[model samples]
Target: MVRILRGLAHKYFSDEEAVILFLLLVTGTIFVIWFGAMLAPAIASLIVAFILQGLVSKLNRMGVPQTVAVISVFLVFMGVLIGFIFGLLPLIWTQVSTLAGEAPRIIRELQSYLSLLPQEYPHLVSEEAVNLIYAEISAEVGHATQWLVSFSLSSIPDLVALLIYMVLVPILVFFFLKDRELIVNSIGRLLPPQRPMMVRIWHEVNLQCANYVRGKAVEILIVGGTTYVAFKLLGMPYAALLSLLVGLSVVIPYIGAAVVTVPVAVIGLFAFGWSSQFIWIMVVYGIIQALDGNVLVPVLFSEVNNLHPVVIIVAVLFFGGIWGLWGVFFAIPLATMLKAVFAAWPVQEDIPAPAQEA
Candidate 1:
């Protein structure tokens, strides 16, 4: 065991830079795990700043002054933020409340539909089975209602924190964008003067993950907006809410789409009742999803490394288990960054055991 441990340490940590990098990774992981919630506003601001930095750079390259570029990008960001909070959020919330109010009716209709299964397919489904299924669904719905009530009752503190974040995040994002150089340089001063491994990791991660992450943000907006417009045109109830789900469903690669389909189907069935309108809604939604996967993804992420489906799924599950929604959102980038780190990591070639004496 000691030999194994020693060999592993020697192989992985033989270099000073590798040791420093390892410590930094460990420290960062510990900090995020322990204090991430408390620093959520700052983290959110950092992400917003990072995403907007590309625009600022583009404007600067186009001969705009740095301060002017910063102000322009920040203004656009605030406008979008304000519009989303004041306009979109209320609409979604209203739909959500309406949906909740209609749940019991939907459940009753579902139960009535299910009760016919045994009559239509007596050999396949028994009456007892239908009753059991209905009971299970009712229980689940009851639990969901209880959870919603509890969540609402317990959300006062969270609402305050959200308001605080609204006030602080934009301010932090503006400064982060404007003082990015100062911040980067200050951080650089703390690191070792020579850091080839770190530099290599950063270069690869930036080349691959930055574009991928930014592309995803754009993809989300496009997919969500397109879905909202399509659903509205189709006269789908809860258009905004369903479209938002459909848009966010892009984040988890294969799984999110499949999972979110259930609600869309359920709502569609209840609204249009297996008629031509329901068929049209499903067809349009499917086309949107297909276009997003086949067309938008390739164009947006042409430069990104195509991780295998299994690897992406594993990454989503692992990181999501660790950090919940944020982990899920950054799963691909984090996985890509780890891949870069592993590629650039310094390791001593294993030394063969000494030859045994005759």
Candidate 2:
């Protein structure tokens, strides 16, 4: 057993550097899995800093001083964060409160509409089934509404957490941006400098992740902004919430748009019924989605993240199960990293070239 283990280790690890890399990966995975929720703020800060680093680099390339670029980028990030908190939060809260307050009425209206189903379709739509569905929906809606009310009213914990994040994330991001090289070098010092596998993985994963992240952020903003404008022009209710959903939906490839579409269509139906406004909204929405899928995605995303749809879905399911939303958000990047690691992983399939009996 000992010999077998050593042979396997030699086949895989082969060297102290490889062993150290393996250990670091295992340790990091364990740390993230165990303490991810506890360190959410720091994790969030790191991600934000990473995203902002690109902009800082761009400014630096344009002859701006490092300090000046960092400050400018940090200020822009802070502005957006603060604006979302103060400006958008109140608006979203108002809309959400209004929606929650009207839930029972909406349910009652839906029940009324369903009542006509028997006359509309006597064979298929039975009154008994409608009653059963209505009862189930009412119960679920009641629980959901109660939960929303309780969550909104009991905001102490949430508010405190938000306060902490607001204070800590910006500070962490500022330092991270300013001391970017220093921080990277500090971490880089721990790893063995001679590991070609590690170097290859880092270079490949770093390029893919940087491009994917920056492009995704741009995609989200563009999709979200375009959606907001369209919704606002169409006089759609809950424009901010719906647009935010549409924007964020772009993050999850192939599934997000479909999922968010149900909500958009439902809300539009409730607001406009079978009116021309609803038709126009659907048309415009379709155009936006078509443009996004066909034009924007191709233009924004480089060929670096040419992952298979199945791989992406599997990664989303795996990481999302472990880390929830953040996992889902970083699913593609993590999957790409995994692919890079595997590609660079040493194998023991060397066959002795054509043994010739001399």
Candidate 3:
């Protein structure tokens, strides 16, 4: 046992640098997991700073002064952030309230429709089965409504936390964006001086993350704006809300589009039943989704996320299981970073080859 343990240690930890890297990684992961709630604001600020870095670089490359560029980009970010909060938040809240208010009516309508199923298809769907399904659905809807009402009423503390985040996050983001170099150098100082492997991994992560974030931002704007316009033209209620869902759905790749489709279809059906308007709206929505997946995504992300579909799904599921929404958003980049680490890691090429049959 001792001999096996020693061999394993020699195999993995022969290089002091590798040992240090492994330890640092373990420590960082543990720290983030342990204090994630307390550190949410800091982590959020870091992500925002990372995203804004692209604009700062663009302005700099246009021969703008660093300070001027930073201020310019920061101002633009603040403008959009404020606009979203003021313009979209109220509309979304109103629509959500509308949906909650209509939930009982929707349930009644659903039950009425289900009641016809037994007469229409007596063999396939028995009256007993219809009653059982209706009861289950009614119970679920009742629970959801109760939860929603409680959550809305109890949001004061949550609002307070949000206010605190709103105050602190921008301040942190501004400093991080302004002092990008100094901050990088400061973090660099904490690591070993001779870390080419780490540096390489950092470069890959930085490049991929920047490209992804920028592309996603553009994607959200283009897709959301287009959806809003289309829904408006179709005279759809809750246009802004549905558009927002469609836009953010890009974040989860395959899963988000499918999930949001349910609400869109349900709302549309309830509004127009099986009428031509609903059919037309659905047709338009399908077109938008198709163009987005086939055209817009390819143009914007173009080789940025070269991960396979299965890998993307697994990453989404794995990270989402761990960190909820933010984890879902960052899953692909984090997984890609892991891929980079494994690729950059110095492996033992001198492992004894399997002996020939003797």
* lDDT, each prediction: 0.90, 0.86, 0.86
TM-score of each: 0.92, 0.89, 0.90
Model 2: CA > 4 A from native: 1-18, 113-133, 344-349, 352-358
Question: Candidate 1: minimum summed lDDT over ten consecutive residues — where?
Answer: 144-153
10 residues in a row with least lDDT, candidate 2: 345-354
> What is the per-residue lDDT of model 3 for residues 270-337, given as tens digits with 9 covering 90 to 100?
88899999999999999999999999988887757477889889999898898898789888778876
lDDT of each residue in 139-258, candidate 1, tens digit only = 988887776667777888988889999999999999999999999999999999998888887888777777777888899999999999999999999999998998888877888899
Model 3 alpha-carbon drift over 4 Å, by segment: 1-15, 121-129, 354-358
TM-score of 3: 0.90
Candidates 1 and 3 compared: the better one by TM-score is 1
Candidate 2, residue 193: Cα displacement in angstroms equals: 3.0
lDDT of 1 at 242: 94
Tens-place lDDT per residue, model 2, 173-225, is: 99999998999889888777676877776777777777877888999999999
- Model 2 pairs in collision: none
Q: Which stretches of candidate 1 lie over 4 Å from their true place?
A: 1-7, 122-129, 146-153, 352-358
RMSD of each: 2.2, 3.0, 2.7
| For model 3, the run of ten residues with the poorest summed lDDT | 344-353
